[model samples]
Target: MGRQWRDGRGKLVVRGESGDVTLPLEIASSLRARRRGLLGRDFVEGALLLSPANSVHTFGMRIPIDVAYLDRRLRVISVRTMKPGRLGLPRLRARHVLEAEAGAMEGWRVRSGALVEVDTDGGSDAHDRPDSAGTPSLPS
Candidate 1:
């Protein structure tokens, strides 16, 4: 992500050793969007990224999810799988939170220490635009 990201749809690109993983991304930069994240969604087509957040809860969620906490530079500080009705502790170093269907992070190669990029300029022809470095799937 950049210094500033607005609430919208975008793309998340993970730079893995094997290759780059690009997935659909929903950005929740505003307080309203971030607070209502994935609460009623049965499944996430890709992933939801909440900025300026260090923790999350699945109080009203319908499915389990994989959560990854990211630091300022977009480096994943930790990743965990959380079931519905559970609460995740805040990571002191985390500046953002990523949520996806349970187990989707493994398939997408999102792990601790991984780096990600957010592409908010996802148009018909915007691919591999390294605006800056640092930035999932459905449930059963």
Candidate 2:
């Protein structure tokens, strides 16, 4: 659930639910979040932005993280672990990127087809109402 960037032959250790993986950094660079609303947060731990067919490098992180590779259309193509201070090789068709706490994806059931919904409005819908028993109703 953390990230580590690499400079050379560094080791990345990701502690998973059942086990762990220590791998080398394929590509290394400074990772920053570009989403609209994440600016004020103290720090972004597990997040990524993939370019179209480019490389990702990690050289200055302290923890391990999970990386999700997305295609140009923002569809997840693959996922893997990147240890601290390593590099991720270029994926020819990669477009978007997502990083998360190690093993969090599996814990949250996040998969290729799972949709990521960004709420830009920052407001709740008026139609969101409670049912007869005071239970919230689902969106139509």
Candidate 3:
């Protein structure tokens, strides 16, 4: 069987004004993976990429997180820091959701309008075109 998007375990490179920020990313595309989310994790070193998601909730979380809603073009639509027990409103234009530690988004300059790239092959360079594996660059 082909590798599923849900099985994605790679690095995410956010090319921002400050420079390039590289971090690990766990992609949640499958129903089961999406449902589980980061519920049990006390801390996340990198971030989680939830495909086909427009909303998220931290109902049972232990810490706050920074969430970025991205449109189909991979352009960030909005960014917010949410605390535990809070339910995020759905974004009509969001095709994906990116979640990371509180304040991490700022450090990475991952605000609205910024683009995100993913390297599933453990590469160091960030490409605006499709990845070497032929996966179209993150929605864009």
Candidate 4:
């Protein structure tokens, strides 16, 4: 029901009624990588994905960000634009979190119930963290 991805670069594809939107993706699966996500950087190339995460904070960030909480199925649970110096509420159903520049998600058709696909450099890893979920990972 959850995904186990390694630290790498890839693409995040969001399919919507309009069309497919692809964006550069950075996978943050390690504790260190996920902890340093988008911090201290002026901006991001596209998006950063934090696996096994349910919430995020922007206490020291320089820029605003668009955050999408995804459930175990990669379906968006909710989307929010967070300003600097804010702590996001944890979504009980979220198993992964996607962060992008402020206002970027709106144009990408990222919203509640939207299904997403992560294409890692070596292909998507299918596994589940016992503490995170109990079913298969990303859709094949």
Candidate 5:
């Protein structure tokens, strides 16, 4: 398997019409980390990035979250807010998934066709090869 995410630690800068929005990045490139997700988190300061993920579920989560589906070029495909115990559909074109606190996407201007740029801070990249071995299927 390729290098796993540096424990989902980094930073991201989303270019907005008014200004750039920066947030803490939590990358999930490993099967284990991807499976764990934000299950027990009550609040998220920034966002969680799941590389090679097409869908997500908030089965055991404590708080609602905003989901952003991005294509290979980091362009947003769609943005939706999912409450706890919800499942998101898989986007065929999505190469990565970004999750944040509820209503965070609107504040950051994350929407369809918007380009998201990842600002690397010495951690695994969104394009890094995701670990496939024993990777469980994500909810759709």
Candidate 6:
């Protein structure tokens, strides 16, 4: 599989039963109209990355996915997937959450404590802050 982001561009080439699919990073990373899984079985086209201590709502997804919860140092705290239309409760010790397509973590060899680099084209500084709505937020 190809890396999804490079120089602020989304580099995904999704191959499904129909054909190849390509999407820009802007469209791929935004959490607008997306859902969050509480129990770790819900799936969505995209994920709203959350810190371990934050809450989330999952809705409107085409499939289920695995949620990789990370700690303050980007270490894996727990991993689970929520079914569509679920809610992930807050975990006091979680640092971040990664919502990957089903089996993506295993396929990419991603594990707890893996360092994730955020790439941007406009050269914006990496900002880690909660959104005004009180959700864990990351820069796109």
TM-score per prediction, in order, is 0.86, 0.48, 0.83, 0.86, 0.80, 0.47
lDDT of 6 by residue, 1-140 (tens): 11222112322232334443332222122342223332444443433343223444456655666676655544456666666667778767665566666666555444554434332343323433223453325556
Q: Which 10 consecutive positions of candidate 3 have the poorest summed lDDT?
A: 125-134
Give me the displacement of residue 13 in model 4, in angstroms: 0.5
lDDT of 4 by residue, 1-140 (tens): 34588988988889798888888999999999999998887788889999989999998899999999998778899999999999999999999999999989998899998978787754544432122354544444
Give the poorly placed runs of model 5, Cα more than 4 Å off.
1-6, 122-140
In model 4, pairs of residues that clash are: 1-135, 1-136
- What clash count does candidate 5 reach? 1
Instruction: Compose the digit string of candidate 5's lDDT tens values, residues 69-106.
Output: 98766778999999999989999988789999999889
Please give the CA lDDT of all the candidate structures.
Answer: 0.85, 0.43, 0.80, 0.85, 0.77, 0.45
The lDDT, on a scale of 0 to 1, for candidate 6 is 0.45
Model 5, residue 97: what's the lDDT? 91
* lDDT: worst 10-residue window of model 1: 131-140
Writing each residue's lDDT as its tens digit, candidate 2 over 21-57 gives 4333222233433222122333444343332234444
Judge candidate 1 against the unseen true structure and give its global Cα lDDT, from 0 to 1: 0.85
Report residue 20 deviation for candidate 2 (angstroms). 27
Across residues 22-81, which tens digit of lDDT does each residue of candidate 3 receive?
A: 888899888888888888788998899888789999998888999999876567899999
Ranking by lDDT: 1, 4, 3, 5, 6, 2
List runs of model 3 lying over 4 Å from the truth: 1-4, 124-140
Error of 3 at 14 (Å): 0.6
Question: CA shift at 96, candidate 6, in angstroms?
Answer: 2.5
